[model samples]
Target: MKEKILNEAERLFWKYGVRTITMDDIARRLAISKKTIYQYFTDKEDIVYQVVNYHIEHEMIECTRLIDQSMNPLEEMLMISDLMRRNADMVNPSLLMDVQRYYPKAWDAFLQHKEGRIITDIKANLQRGVDQGLYRTDIDLETMARLRVELIQLGFDDRAFPNNKDVMTTQDQLLHLFLRGILSEQGFTVYNTLKNKEYNLTAYENK
Candidate 1:
């Protein structure tokens, strides 16, 4: 029952956004009384906390799984980017922002989770990459990792995906702009070569 409420809440929040959703809305969708909804959740914040926890826990677990299995740090970094891109499309980017904009506690929880787990995982992968000569030694891993997460978030902003997205931000263009500033010559060559390879986001239904 708890899980059902969370799932229904997430689906509603995803399409309509957290701010626009009410406990009545959740209860109606769940076919439960508003009083029944309150029995499990004190308010929308409680529901949102559950939702954020759902996302953060999965995100952290996914980050760990990718990092643990990756043979190299660069691969780890790319996977993180890929995860953000795919997850944004799958989940509610707008709801993600609303959490930050309206729910300070949830936002703090997310930041703490990122700092304590996700960013640390990224830093470890970055250190490994530097050791393997895949990334520049001069670059600070912590800062770079934070930047990557922020950039990924920025990439999902509706403004970034303009209505007139006649010219969208290609994966190649994004990689070229960011990777060029950080990789060594050998790194640049590998990145450029990979960048030249075909990317398949056209399946994103960008039109």
Candidate 2:
């Protein structure tokens, strides 16, 4: 029952920003009584914190799996970017802003994920890419890895690039730019080959 509530709340919260999604909304969406929800959660903030923690834990597992199974660094990045692009559609534009503004505890969970596990993951990916010659060796690994981490937030910046949910998404463009900036000449060739075959960038308007 707890898992069910968290799952439904996650879906609702993703579709509707956290600030607007009330306990009643979650209970109504799940067709359960408010009493049932209260049994599992002390308040809306408690639910939000648990939900955010659940999401981060699940994402970390998937990210590790993706990185481990990738054919190369470029393929790993492309896979991650594709996943993000798909997820961006389900995410409400105000979600991050709402979390930061209203839910301090949940926001701290997000920050922990961003600054800790996420940074470690990207740094490992960059090091692996550099060793494999899929990324430029001369680049400062730490600085570039941190930059990539920070750039991840840009996808949620609605004011900068509003969610179009179209063929050419802002997230997609940002991914292309970030990948191209880090690739070696050899890496670029590999990127082009796979990108043409897999993504078919020509299908998008920005191409």
Candidate 3:
């Protein structure tokens, strides 16, 4: 029951901003009583925190799985980028702003995930790519990795891309530009081919 509540809550939260979702709304969406939700979570804040934690943990697991299965560092990045793009498509642009403004603790958790594990993972990936000759050796791995990490968060800024039609394209172009900057000659060829390939986003549908 708890898992069901969280799943439904997460689905709604992703599609709608968190601040606007009340306990009654969640209960209505799940066709359950508010008491049932209260039995598992103390309040909306509790639900948000748990939901964010679950979301981050699931993403980390997926990241690890993709890295493990990838043939090379570049492939892992491409997969992750597609995953991010698909997810961004589903999320409400105001979701992050709402969380940051209304849910301090949940926001802190997200910050920790971004600054800690996400940065570490990106740096490691960059180093691996460099070693594999897929990335430019002349680049400063740490700095470039951090820059990439920072750029990813910009997708959440609705103001940055005020024209809704261009949001996804702009975000994708940011990633592609980064890839072009880092890829070696052979890596560029591989990237061009992979970019031209039809990426199946069905796996991330309604993420």
> Which candidate number would show the highest TM-score if scored against the true structure?
3
Better of 2 and 3 by TM-score: 3
Q: Compared with the true structure, what per-residue lDDT tens digits does model 2 show for residues 58-89?
A: 76666666777778878888877766565656
Please give the ranking of all candidate structures by lDDT, highest first, separated by commas: 3, 2, 1
What TM-score does each of the candidates earn?
A: 0.78, 0.88, 0.92
Instruction: Please list the residue runs of candidate 2 whose C-alpha ends up more than 4 Å from where it truly belongs after superposition.
Output: 162-168, 197-207
The sequence of per-residue lDDT tens digits that candidate 3 reaches over residues 30-101 is 889999999999999999999998889888877787788778888888888887777777887788878888
Residue 118 of model 2, lDDT score: 78
Q: Which stretches of candidate 1 lie over 4 Å from their true place?
A: 156-176, 192-207
Residue 24 of model 3 has an lDDT of 92
lDDT, candidate 2, at 156: 63
CA lDDT of each prediction against the hidden true structure = 0.68, 0.78, 0.83
TM-score: model 1 vs. ground truth? 0.78
RMSD of each: 4.7, 5.1, 1.8
Pick by lDDT: 1 or 2, better one: 2
